[model samples]
Target: MKNEDQAAMLLLGVGGGGCRLAASVRAVYGAGLHAVGVDTDALANRNAAAGGMTCLLLGGSRLSGHGTGGDAIQGRLAAQDDMQNLQAQMNGVRTAVVMACLGGGTGGGSTPEIVKALGEMGIATVCFVTMPFGFEGQARRKEAERVLPMIEESADSLVVVPLDDLLKDAGEDLMLENAVNIAEGIIAAGITLLWRLLSKPGFISLDAEKLHTMVMRGGNALFGCGSAAGDDRAIKSVAALRGCSLLRSGEALKRANALMLGILAGSDLRLAEVGEVMCEVNKSCKPGCHVEMGTVFDPAYEGRIELVALAFESWTAAVMAVPKSETEVAAEPPVADVIPARVGGRKVRSKGGSKLSFGATGRGKFKGVEPTLYNNQDLDVPTFIRRGIRLER
Candidate 1:
């Protein structure tokens, strides 16, 4: 990937859990990655800053940098207060990968506002949010669920990772701390794979432009990754990926309308291995699924193969087409050649216009009353009718 492309993308972490996740991804991807973390807790911000990521404290004056204490409303207000500071960090960024863990105050509350801000700035955002584990109790789960729709509304592509599903394969005896670490590691690895696919030199490159276009069309996505080594590493990696709980044991692929697959391996990777991986993945996916494949070679990945897949279930090609303005829509020919019209107490047929009453142009009894106006436009009449625009059938 070129430096310009890398500079255009940003990895943003919101709140404590989100900051930690961003730190993990940065640690794996190293120097070139541009990352920033925003949180209500001053201490947490300092810790994340220690990891070499730029950190900003939200609601420093109002909350005194203490934190929201799981109050999502406070978190939301904090983000709003410090929104300009966050926007300053987004100078040249065109695509933002936002990581947040829902259920907690900052993550649940601040994420929606931040994502919305990024969208308003014309930055494409792919949000990766983790839902609380079942063991975390009903309250936390409910909190996460409540904030989900808000994030979904603003994010271009949303990848939801339910912690319960993520840790299902871990042994029941696993410690809570270890389980959390493992989940973060797995998610970080998948994100790293995606970053490498776009930033590293590869046999077949998946550039930032392509990623932006795909994400614009990919409403919600499923992300998962797996690794394997030894003679049959490529095949084994695919099998492991198929079994990934995040992907619902390959069910996501079957239902996906589009997929972005990245293969990372060492210099010894064989041409046949690449073919084998693709072939197996293709078998798992439904017919007519759009697949974008890329391969990355690095010395660090010697003797192993890492496979990452992002499945977009709601992918639609219609979004790729440019939307028409009201003027353009109104200019289209009417569905019917002629329509009935009233003229001087006689019925007449009018050509090139539909008989459909798009909407009432004037207020019936309230016409003589004072009209409500906004920005110099009368709010009493329907906007289309006021603008003198006709609707096509």
Candidate 2:
């Protein structure tokens, strides 16, 4: 590997699903890219080599790489034990990307912990994760929801793709394996374009620091990757991007306050084509939005154009810069009443994992129901209501 390869962005895949994605990304980008796949299952680690990326087998003593048997705690412990080795892979990389599919044990259990570990390194981390399909069962879906907030808290920002949404438009004759393979290819292509924008600079030159500000300073985001070849490829590529299911067919883009676009084109890319793409982007966003643009000229895409666009919520540029009107100005967001932590109850820690230790807790209006643990908080009936945290519309 060249010095460029060693110091370029790092892509880390966690668990079986993530390893497959890492492999897919490696196959497309080839040299000048470092990819690593970590898993508790030795078999998953082995099978992940379809594209020949580095693989790490974790939890040799406890799981012996036999697999976590769909247990998240085991998956988490496996990654925890091998954390030093995993962190070593991130050294010197400009940025780190994590890929994982939630719902199963290893992906769900270890993803948040892995994000937390990357956070400790003070590197800008972005995660692209998948939620379980509606048909995948309540247990998996619940598990995905359980750790989602934690993962968001750990990573700078993340893009979540629900499996059901991804699979909704599959053709009737498409086999499940083929559908998964197709999705992985698309994902790999997107990852390739993103790193190209950072490591391989073009005329506009968006560096690691600028890319960091675009991603890390925003809320959760929507990402889409698409490509087109032949006449008017730039316009066609942006159209393809707006049509991807992962981006909710661009409905999310319309609501976003912060947007970043990375374009990869052949040496023949024209200025007019660039202008057309920018026009489409400006038309899509409302006034007061922040847009970042970067382009890379690659001989590999000589006759084609590829685009990777990310749309995210921004408090500074969008929310604060709302349009003004003399007659009726926008009012500030409503503040809801605060919920009390101590509602006439004696707080006591539970001895084991099977006990509720709140004594004589008076849950104001919820009437009858036991307190449940959410985000590491214990509370009575209607936890959100009792906690006084109203959900914003």
The whole-model lDDT of each prediction reads: 0.80, 0.71
- Going through the candidates in order, what is the number of backbone clashes in each? 0, 0
lDDT of 2 by residue, 1-393 (tens): 358655656888988998888888787787557888999899888887556778888787889989787889998998899988887777686567899999878888889888877765556678889888776799999999998977876676688878766665565687878878877876777777776665665687455555655565455788776678998787788887787777788776677777778888888899899898888877767776677788877688899988888887532342222234545543332223112332211111211233333234544332242232222233344444444566899
State how far residue 196 of model 2 sits from its true place (Å).
1.2
Cα lDDT tens digits, model 1, 27-92, are 999978999999999999999999999999999998999999999999999999999999999888
Query: What does the lDDT come to for candidate 1?
Result: 0.80
lDDT of 1 at 195: 73
